[model samples]
Target: MSSPSTPAGDLAFVVRTIARTAVDNEGAFGDLDAVAGDGDFGYSLARGFEIVLADWDTLDPGTPDEFLKKVALVISKRVGGTSGPLWGTAFLRAAGAVKDRTELDAADAVAMLRAAAEGIKARGKSDLGDKTLLDALIPMTDALEQRLAEGGPGAGPAELAALAASTARTSADATTSMQARRGRQSYTGERSIGSPDPGAVAVAVMAERVAAEWDVRD
Candidate 1:
Protein backbone atom coordinates (compact mmCIF):
# COMPACT_ATOMS: atom_id res chain seq x y z
CA MET A 1 0.00 0.00 0.00
CA SER A 2 2.43 2.66 1.19
CA SER A 3 5.45 3.07 -1.00
CA PRO A 4 7.36 5.71 -3.05
CA SER A 5 4.04 6.43 -4.72
CA THR A 6 2.61 7.64 -1.44
CA PRO A 7 5.66 9.79 -0.66
CA ALA A 8 5.46 9.83 3.11
CA GLY A 9 7.12 12.70 4.88
CA ASP A 10 6.39 15.46 7.38
CA LEU A 11 2.86 16.82 7.34
CA ALA A 12 4.45 20.23 7.57
CA PHE A 13 5.67 19.83 4.03
CA VAL A 14 2.10 19.71 2.82
CA VAL A 15 0.92 22.57 5.01
CA ARG A 16 3.90 24.81 4.41
CA THR A 17 3.95 24.31 0.66
CA ILE A 18 0.27 25.13 0.26
CA ALA A 19 0.28 27.86 2.90
CA ARG A 20 3.29 29.69 1.53
CA THR A 21 1.80 29.80 -1.95
CA ALA A 22 -1.64 30.78 -0.68
CA VAL A 23 -0.09 33.34 1.67
CA ASP A 24 1.64 34.98 -1.24
CA ASN A 25 -1.55 35.13 -3.31
CA GLU A 26 -4.04 35.78 -0.49
CA GLY A 27 -3.15 39.45 -0.40
CA ALA A 28 -3.79 39.78 -4.10
CA PHE A 29 -7.19 38.26 -3.66
CA GLY A 30 -7.98 40.86 -1.02
CA ASP A 31 -6.73 43.56 -3.33
CA LEU A 32 -9.31 42.50 -5.85
CA ASP A 33 -12.03 42.99 -3.26
CA ALA A 34 -10.74 46.01 -1.37
CA VAL A 35 -13.72 48.11 -2.37
CA ALA A 36 -16.38 45.77 -0.96
CA GLY A 37 -14.76 43.13 1.20
CA ASP A 38 -13.10 43.65 4.56
CA GLY A 39 -9.82 43.04 2.74
CA ASP A 40 -8.51 40.81 5.50
CA PHE A 41 -8.59 37.58 3.53
CA GLY A 42 -4.94 37.76 2.52
CA TYR A 43 -3.66 38.28 6.05
CA SER A 44 -6.16 35.89 7.56
CA LEU A 45 -5.10 33.02 5.30
CA ALA A 46 -1.43 33.77 5.84
CA ARG A 47 -1.96 33.73 9.60
CA GLY A 48 -3.84 30.47 9.39
CA PHE A 49 -1.06 28.89 7.31
CA GLU A 50 1.57 30.22 9.67
CA ILE A 51 -0.22 28.84 12.70
CA VAL A 52 -1.02 25.50 11.01
CA LEU A 53 2.68 24.88 10.49
CA ALA A 54 3.61 25.49 14.13
CA ASP A 55 2.65 21.92 15.09
CA TRP A 56 3.19 20.23 11.74
CA ASP A 57 6.24 18.27 12.85
CA THR A 58 4.45 16.93 15.92
CA LEU A 59 1.67 15.34 13.87
CA ASP A 60 2.80 12.07 12.33
CA PRO A 61 -0.62 11.29 10.97
CA GLY A 62 -0.85 7.91 9.31
CA THR A 63 -3.14 9.19 6.61
CA PRO A 64 -4.24 12.31 4.74
CA ASP A 65 -7.43 12.20 6.78
CA GLU A 66 -5.62 12.83 10.05
CA PHE A 67 -3.56 15.60 8.54
CA LEU A 68 -6.62 17.34 7.12
CA LYS A 69 -8.44 17.10 10.43
CA LYS A 70 -5.54 18.84 12.14
CA VAL A 71 -5.45 21.45 9.41
CA ALA A 72 -9.19 21.98 9.87
CA LEU A 73 -8.61 22.92 13.49
CA VAL A 74 -5.93 25.39 12.58
CA ILE A 75 -7.84 26.81 9.59
CA SER A 76 -10.94 27.40 11.69
CA LYS A 77 -8.99 28.99 14.52
CA ARG A 78 -6.61 31.03 12.41
CA VAL A 79 -9.06 32.48 9.93
CA GLY A 80 -12.01 34.56 11.17
CA GLY A 81 -14.55 34.51 8.40
CA THR A 82 -17.02 32.35 6.53
CA SER A 83 -14.09 31.15 4.47
CA GLY A 84 -12.40 29.65 7.52
CA PRO A 85 -15.12 27.15 8.34
CA LEU A 86 -15.85 26.45 4.69
CA TRP A 87 -12.27 25.63 3.77
CA GLY A 88 -11.73 23.77 7.02
CA THR A 89 -14.67 21.53 6.29
CA ALA A 90 -13.49 20.94 2.76
CA PHE A 91 -10.05 19.92 3.96
CA LEU A 92 -11.49 17.73 6.73
CA ARG A 93 -13.80 15.91 4.36
CA ALA A 94 -11.00 15.42 1.86
CA ALA A 95 -8.86 14.06 4.69
CA GLY A 96 -11.57 11.58 5.58
CA ALA A 97 -11.79 10.41 1.98
CA VAL A 98 -8.21 9.16 2.03
CA LYS A 99 -7.87 8.21 5.67
CA ASP A 100 -6.96 4.58 5.01
CA ARG A 101 -4.82 5.04 1.95
CA THR A 102 -1.13 4.26 2.35
CA GLU A 103 -0.57 5.34 -1.23
CA LEU A 104 -2.69 7.74 -3.30
CA ASP A 105 -3.31 7.20 -7.01
CA ALA A 106 -4.99 9.34 -9.66
CA ALA A 107 -8.34 7.93 -8.68
CA ASP A 108 -7.61 8.54 -5.03
CA ALA A 109 -6.70 12.11 -5.85
CA VAL A 110 -10.01 12.62 -7.62
CA ALA A 111 -11.84 11.22 -4.63
CA MET A 112 -10.15 13.75 -2.35
CA LEU A 113 -11.25 16.64 -4.56
CA ARG A 114 -14.79 15.34 -4.89
CA ALA A 115 -14.97 14.94 -1.15
CA ALA A 116 -13.76 18.50 -0.75
CA ALA A 117 -16.52 19.86 -2.98
CA GLU A 118 -19.19 17.94 -1.14
CA GLY A 119 -17.81 19.11 2.20
CA ILE A 120 -17.93 22.76 1.20
CA LYS A 121 -21.42 22.38 -0.21
CA ALA A 122 -22.69 20.63 2.90
CA ARG A 123 -21.12 23.10 5.28
CA GLY A 124 -21.70 26.34 3.39
CA LYS A 125 -25.08 25.39 1.95
CA SER A 126 -23.81 26.66 -1.38
CA ASP A 127 -24.40 25.13 -4.78
CA LEU A 128 -22.67 25.12 -8.15
CA GLY A 129 -24.52 27.95 -9.93
CA ASP A 130 -24.51 30.11 -6.83
CA LYS A 131 -20.86 30.80 -7.56
CA THR A 132 -18.75 30.00 -4.55
CA LEU A 133 -15.68 27.80 -4.40
CA LEU A 134 -18.05 25.12 -5.57
CA ASP A 135 -18.13 26.83 -8.91
CA ALA A 136 -14.45 26.11 -9.29
CA LEU A 137 -14.30 22.85 -7.39
CA ILE A 138 -17.13 20.99 -9.10
CA PRO A 139 -15.82 21.49 -12.61
CA MET A 140 -12.30 20.61 -11.53
CA THR A 141 -13.58 17.45 -9.89
CA ASP A 142 -15.47 16.56 -13.02
CA ALA A 143 -12.45 17.10 -15.20
CA LEU A 144 -10.23 14.93 -13.01
CA GLU A 145 -12.77 12.15 -12.86
CA GLN A 146 -13.27 12.31 -16.59
CA ARG A 147 -9.58 12.17 -17.23
CA LEU A 148 -9.14 9.23 -14.89
CA ALA A 149 -12.05 7.33 -16.43
CA GLU A 150 -10.38 7.64 -19.82
CA GLY A 151 -7.69 5.19 -18.62
CA GLY A 152 -5.70 8.22 -17.44
CA PRO A 153 -3.12 8.47 -20.21
CA GLY A 154 0.01 7.48 -18.29
CA ALA A 155 -1.24 9.36 -15.25
CA GLY A 156 0.37 9.71 -11.87
CA PRO A 157 0.19 12.15 -8.99
CA ALA A 158 2.16 14.72 -10.96
CA GLU A 159 -0.15 14.50 -13.96
CA LEU A 160 -3.22 14.49 -11.77
CA ALA A 161 -1.96 17.53 -9.90
CA ALA A 162 -1.37 19.34 -13.14
CA LEU A 163 -4.87 18.53 -14.32
CA ALA A 164 -6.26 19.77 -10.99
CA ALA A 165 -4.32 23.00 -11.27
CA SER A 166 -5.55 23.55 -14.80
CA THR A 167 -9.11 22.85 -13.81
CA ALA A 168 -8.91 25.17 -10.82
CA ARG A 169 -7.31 27.94 -12.82
CA THR A 170 -9.97 27.83 -15.51
CA SER A 171 -12.74 27.77 -12.92
CA ALA A 172 -11.34 30.73 -11.04
CA ASP A 173 -10.95 32.72 -14.21
CA ALA A 174 -14.48 31.91 -15.22
CA THR A 175 -15.77 33.46 -12.00
CA THR A 176 -15.29 36.95 -13.39
CA SER A 177 -18.72 36.82 -15.00
CA MET A 178 -20.48 35.23 -12.06
CA GLN A 179 -22.57 37.08 -9.52
CA ALA A 180 -21.96 36.50 -5.85
CA ARG A 181 -24.78 34.41 -4.42
CA ARG A 182 -23.06 33.33 -1.23
CA GLY A 183 -20.67 34.39 1.49
CA ARG A 184 -19.54 37.95 2.19
CA GLN A 185 -20.30 39.10 -1.30
CA SER A 186 -23.83 37.73 -1.42
CA TYR A 187 -25.15 40.84 0.19
CA THR A 188 -23.79 42.97 -2.61
CA GLY A 189 -25.76 41.35 -5.42
CA GLU A 190 -24.73 43.00 -8.65
CA ARG A 191 -22.04 44.89 -6.83
CA SER A 192 -20.21 41.61 -6.57
CA ILE A 193 -19.74 41.59 -10.29
CA GLY A 194 -16.44 42.28 -12.05
CA SER A 195 -14.40 41.35 -8.97
CA PRO A 196 -13.65 37.66 -8.60
CA ASP A 197 -14.57 35.95 -5.36
CA PRO A 198 -11.74 35.49 -2.88
CA GLY A 199 -12.59 31.86 -2.21
CA ALA A 200 -12.47 31.03 -5.89
CA VAL A 201 -9.06 32.63 -6.22
CA ALA A 202 -7.82 30.78 -3.15
CA VAL A 203 -8.94 27.50 -4.66
CA ALA A 204 -6.52 28.04 -7.51
CA VAL A 205 -3.74 28.66 -5.04
CA MET A 206 -4.61 25.58 -3.02
CA ALA A 207 -4.72 23.34 -6.10
CA GLU A 208 -1.42 24.61 -7.49
CA ARG A 209 0.44 24.10 -4.25
CA VAL A 210 -0.97 20.64 -3.75
CA ALA A 211 0.16 19.60 -7.22
CA ALA A 212 3.64 21.06 -6.87
CA GLU A 213 4.33 19.45 -3.51
CA TRP A 214 2.80 16.09 -4.34
CA ASP A 215 4.08 15.76 -7.90
CA VAL A 216 6.13 12.55 -8.12
CA ARG A 217 7.69 13.25 -11.51
CA ASP A 218 11.43 13.85 -11.65
Candidate 2:
Protein backbone atom coordinates (compact mmCIF):
# COMPACT_ATOMS: atom_id res chain seq x y z
CA MET A 1 0.00 0.00 0.00
CA SER A 2 1.45 3.27 -1.14
CA SER A 3 1.05 6.46 0.86
CA PRO A 4 -1.14 9.24 -0.47
CA SER A 5 0.88 12.06 -2.03
CA THR A 6 -1.85 14.58 -2.79
CA PRO A 7 -4.16 16.55 -0.53
CA ALA A 8 -7.32 14.94 -1.88
CA GLY A 9 -5.83 11.50 -1.56
CA ASP A 10 -4.62 12.24 1.94
CA LEU A 11 -8.05 13.52 2.98
CA ALA A 12 -9.68 10.43 1.56
CA PHE A 13 -7.29 8.19 3.42
CA VAL A 14 -7.91 9.95 6.72
CA VAL A 15 -11.71 10.02 6.37
CA ARG A 16 -11.74 6.36 5.45
CA THR A 17 -9.61 5.49 8.45
CA ILE A 18 -11.82 7.47 10.83
CA ALA A 19 -15.02 6.00 9.40
CA ARG A 20 -13.68 2.49 9.63
CA THR A 21 -12.44 3.03 13.16
CA ALA A 22 -15.80 4.33 14.30
CA VAL A 23 -17.65 1.46 12.69
CA ASP A 24 -15.30 -1.20 14.01
CA ASN A 25 -15.20 0.13 17.58
CA GLU A 26 -18.95 0.68 17.95
CA GLY A 27 -19.43 -1.78 20.79
CA ALA A 28 -16.32 -0.66 22.62
CA PHE A 29 -17.21 2.98 22.29
CA GLY A 30 -20.77 2.35 23.44
CA ASP A 31 -19.45 0.47 26.45
CA LEU A 32 -17.13 3.34 27.31
CA ASP A 33 -19.98 5.81 26.96
CA ALA A 34 -22.13 3.62 29.20
CA VAL A 35 -19.57 4.15 31.96
CA ALA A 36 -20.35 7.86 31.95
CA GLY A 37 -23.33 8.90 29.85
CA ASP A 38 -25.87 7.05 27.73
CA GLY A 39 -24.36 4.32 25.58
CA ASP A 40 -25.25 6.01 22.28
CA PHE A 41 -21.93 7.52 21.33
CA GLY A 42 -20.80 4.49 19.38
CA TYR A 43 -24.15 4.01 17.72
CA SER A 44 -24.36 7.62 16.60
CA LEU A 45 -20.78 7.69 15.36
CA ALA A 46 -21.11 4.41 13.53
CA ARG A 47 -24.38 5.41 11.93
CA GLY A 48 -22.90 8.65 10.67
CA PHE A 49 -19.76 7.01 9.31
CA GLU A 50 -21.79 4.22 7.83
CA ILE A 51 -23.50 6.80 5.71
CA VAL A 52 -20.15 8.22 4.72
CA LEU A 53 -18.93 4.82 3.61
CA ALA A 54 -22.17 4.06 1.85
CA ASP A 55 -21.98 7.31 -0.05
CA TRP A 56 -18.24 7.19 -0.66
CA ASP A 57 -18.59 6.62 -4.37
CA THR A 58 -20.94 9.56 -4.79
CA LEU A 59 -19.06 12.23 -2.87
CA ASP A 60 -16.93 14.52 -4.92
CA PRO A 61 -13.21 13.92 -4.56
CA GLY A 62 -12.08 16.94 -6.52
CA THR A 63 -10.61 18.73 -3.51
CA PRO A 64 -9.92 17.99 0.12
CA ASP A 65 -12.06 20.80 1.49
CA GLU A 66 -14.95 19.93 -0.77
CA PHE A 67 -14.81 16.31 0.28
CA LEU A 68 -14.71 17.28 3.95
CA LYS A 69 -17.64 19.65 3.57
CA LYS A 70 -19.72 16.94 1.97
CA VAL A 71 -18.79 14.59 4.76
CA ALA A 72 -19.76 17.21 7.31
CA LEU A 73 -23.18 17.52 5.73
CA VAL A 74 -23.64 13.79 5.85
CA ILE A 75 -22.64 13.55 9.49
CA SER A 76 -24.78 16.50 10.55
CA LYS A 77 -27.86 15.28 8.78
CA ARG A 78 -27.66 11.52 9.21
CA VAL A 79 -26.20 11.12 12.67
CA GLY A 80 -28.39 11.32 15.77
CA GLY A 81 -27.66 12.89 19.15
CA THR A 82 -25.17 15.60 20.09
CA SER A 83 -22.37 13.68 18.44
CA GLY A 84 -23.68 14.73 15.04
CA PRO A 85 -23.50 18.45 15.62
CA LEU A 86 -20.13 18.32 17.39
CA TRP A 87 -18.33 16.08 14.93
CA GLY A 88 -20.02 17.72 11.98
CA THR A 89 -18.87 21.10 13.14
CA ALA A 90 -15.35 19.81 13.51
CA PHE A 91 -15.29 18.60 9.93
CA LEU A 92 -16.94 21.76 8.66
CA ARG A 93 -14.40 23.97 10.36
CA ALA A 94 -11.59 21.80 9.13
CA ALA A 95 -12.89 22.20 5.61
CA GLY A 96 -13.08 25.94 6.04
CA ALA A 97 -9.51 26.08 7.28
CA VAL A 98 -8.15 24.84 4.01
CA LYS A 99 -10.71 26.27 1.64
CA ASP A 100 -9.41 26.86 -1.89
CA ARG A 101 -6.07 25.29 -1.10
CA THR A 102 -4.68 23.07 -3.84
CA GLU A 103 -2.13 21.47 -1.60
CA LEU A 104 -1.37 21.11 2.09
CA ASP A 105 1.66 20.95 4.36
CA ALA A 106 2.22 20.35 8.05
CA ALA A 107 1.16 23.87 8.92
CA ASP A 108 -2.11 23.43 7.04
CA ALA A 109 -2.75 20.22 8.91
CA VAL A 110 -2.16 21.96 12.24
CA ALA A 111 -4.40 24.80 11.25
CA MET A 112 -7.16 22.44 10.26
CA LEU A 113 -6.92 20.65 13.59
CA ARG A 114 -6.99 23.94 15.44
CA ALA A 115 -10.03 25.05 13.50
CA ALA A 116 -11.76 21.77 14.25
CA ALA A 117 -10.98 22.13 17.95
CA GLU A 118 -12.39 25.63 17.99
CA GLY A 119 -15.50 24.45 16.20
CA ILE A 120 -15.96 21.69 18.74
CA LYS A 121 -15.49 24.16 21.56
CA ALA A 122 -18.10 26.49 20.13
CA ARG A 123 -20.58 23.79 19.19
CA GLY A 124 -20.35 21.83 22.41
CA LYS A 125 -20.01 24.90 24.61
CA SER A 126 -17.04 23.20 26.16
CA ASP A 127 -13.37 23.76 26.73
CA LEU A 128 -10.24 22.03 27.80
CA GLY A 129 -10.31 20.26 31.19
CA ASP A 130 -14.05 19.84 30.78
CA LYS A 131 -13.52 16.10 30.60
CA THR A 132 -14.67 16.11 27.01
CA LEU A 133 -12.86 15.19 23.84
CA LEU A 134 -11.30 18.64 23.92
CA ASP A 135 -9.00 17.36 26.62
CA ALA A 136 -7.42 14.95 24.16
CA LEU A 137 -7.99 16.88 20.92
CA ILE A 138 -6.36 20.12 22.04
CA PRO A 139 -3.30 18.42 23.48
CA MET A 140 -2.88 16.26 20.41
CA THR A 141 -3.05 19.31 18.18
CA ASP A 142 -0.56 21.11 20.39
CA ALA A 143 1.85 18.21 20.22
CA LEU A 144 1.61 18.11 16.45
CA GLU A 145 2.20 21.86 16.19
CA GLN A 146 5.12 21.69 18.61
CA ARG A 147 6.69 18.80 16.75
CA LEU A 148 6.33 20.68 13.49
CA ALA A 149 7.87 23.79 15.04
CA GLU A 150 10.81 21.81 16.38
CA GLY A 151 11.47 20.51 12.84
CA GLY A 152 14.27 18.16 13.73
CA PRO A 153 15.58 15.54 11.32
CA GLY A 154 13.23 12.59 10.71
CA ALA A 155 10.25 14.55 12.01
CA GLY A 156 8.10 13.46 9.13
CA PRO A 157 4.36 12.89 8.80
CA ALA A 158 4.39 9.45 10.38
CA GLU A 159 6.52 10.57 13.33
CA LEU A 160 4.34 13.61 13.99
CA ALA A 161 1.17 11.48 13.74
CA ALA A 162 2.63 8.99 16.20
CA LEU A 163 3.48 11.78 18.62
CA ALA A 164 -0.03 13.22 18.36
CA ALA A 165 -1.57 9.79 18.86
CA SER A 166 0.58 9.22 21.96
CA THR A 167 -0.37 12.60 23.34
CA ALA A 168 -4.07 11.97 22.65
CA ARG A 169 -3.98 8.60 24.45
CA THR A 170 -2.19 10.04 27.48
CA SER A 171 -4.53 13.02 27.63
CA ALA A 172 -7.59 10.80 27.30
CA ASP A 173 -6.32 8.70 30.20
CA ALA A 174 -5.87 11.83 32.27
CA THR A 175 -9.57 12.57 31.86
CA THR A 176 -10.31 9.76 34.31
CA SER A 177 -9.22 12.09 37.10
CA MET A 178 -11.50 14.92 36.02
CA GLN A 179 -15.19 15.23 36.81
CA ALA A 180 -17.32 15.84 33.77
CA ARG A 181 -18.39 19.48 33.46
CA ARG A 182 -20.25 19.21 30.21
CA GLY A 183 -22.58 16.86 28.35
CA ARG A 184 -24.84 14.19 29.77
CA GLN A 185 -22.08 12.75 31.94
CA SER A 186 -22.02 15.95 33.97
CA TYR A 187 -25.33 14.95 35.51
CA THR A 188 -23.47 12.18 37.34
CA GLY A 189 -20.93 14.69 38.71
CA GLU A 190 -18.19 12.88 40.65
CA ARG A 191 -19.19 9.55 39.22
CA SER A 192 -17.78 10.63 35.88
CA ILE A 193 -14.33 11.02 37.42
CA GLY A 194 -13.60 7.33 37.52
CA SER A 195 -14.16 6.86 33.80
CA PRO A 196 -12.48 8.60 30.89
CA ASP A 197 -14.57 10.61 28.44
CA PRO A 198 -15.77 8.38 25.65
CA GLY A 199 -15.29 11.11 23.07
CA ALA A 200 -11.70 11.63 24.18
CA VAL A 201 -11.06 7.92 24.07
CA ALA A 202 -12.54 7.80 20.59
CA VAL A 203 -10.22 10.57 19.46
CA ALA A 204 -7.26 8.75 20.92
CA VAL A 205 -8.26 5.51 19.26
CA MET A 206 -8.73 7.18 15.90
CA ALA A 207 -5.43 9.01 16.14
CA GLU A 208 -3.66 5.80 17.08
CA ARG A 209 -5.24 4.01 14.16
CA VAL A 210 -4.23 6.76 11.74
CA ALA A 211 -0.68 6.73 13.00
CA ALA A 212 -0.35 2.96 12.91
CA GLU A 213 -1.72 2.77 9.40
CA TRP A 214 -0.18 5.92 7.93
CA ASP A 215 2.62 4.12 6.17
CA VAL A 216 0.34 1.58 4.57
CA ARG A 217 -2.43 3.78 3.18
CA ASP A 218 -2.62 4.66 -0.44
Worst 10 residues of 2 by lDDT: 1-10
List candidate 2 segments past 4 Å from native: 1-3
Over 4 Å off, model 1: 1-15, 210-218
lDDT of 2 by residue, 54-152 (tens): 998887655768888999999999888999999999999999999988787888889999999999999999999999999999999998888888888
Candidate 1 residue lDDT tens string, 1-218: 12333344433354567777767776686786564567877777777877766766665545666777888888988887777888788778888888877665657667877998898898899988776778878988998888778873556556767788888888888887888887777788888788667777778777787777674422
Q: Candidate 2: give the clashing pairs.
A: none
What's the CA RMSD for each of the models? 3.0, 1.5
Q: After superposition, how far is residue 22 of candidate 1 from its true place, in Å?
A: 2.2
Q: State model 2's lDDT.
A: 0.91
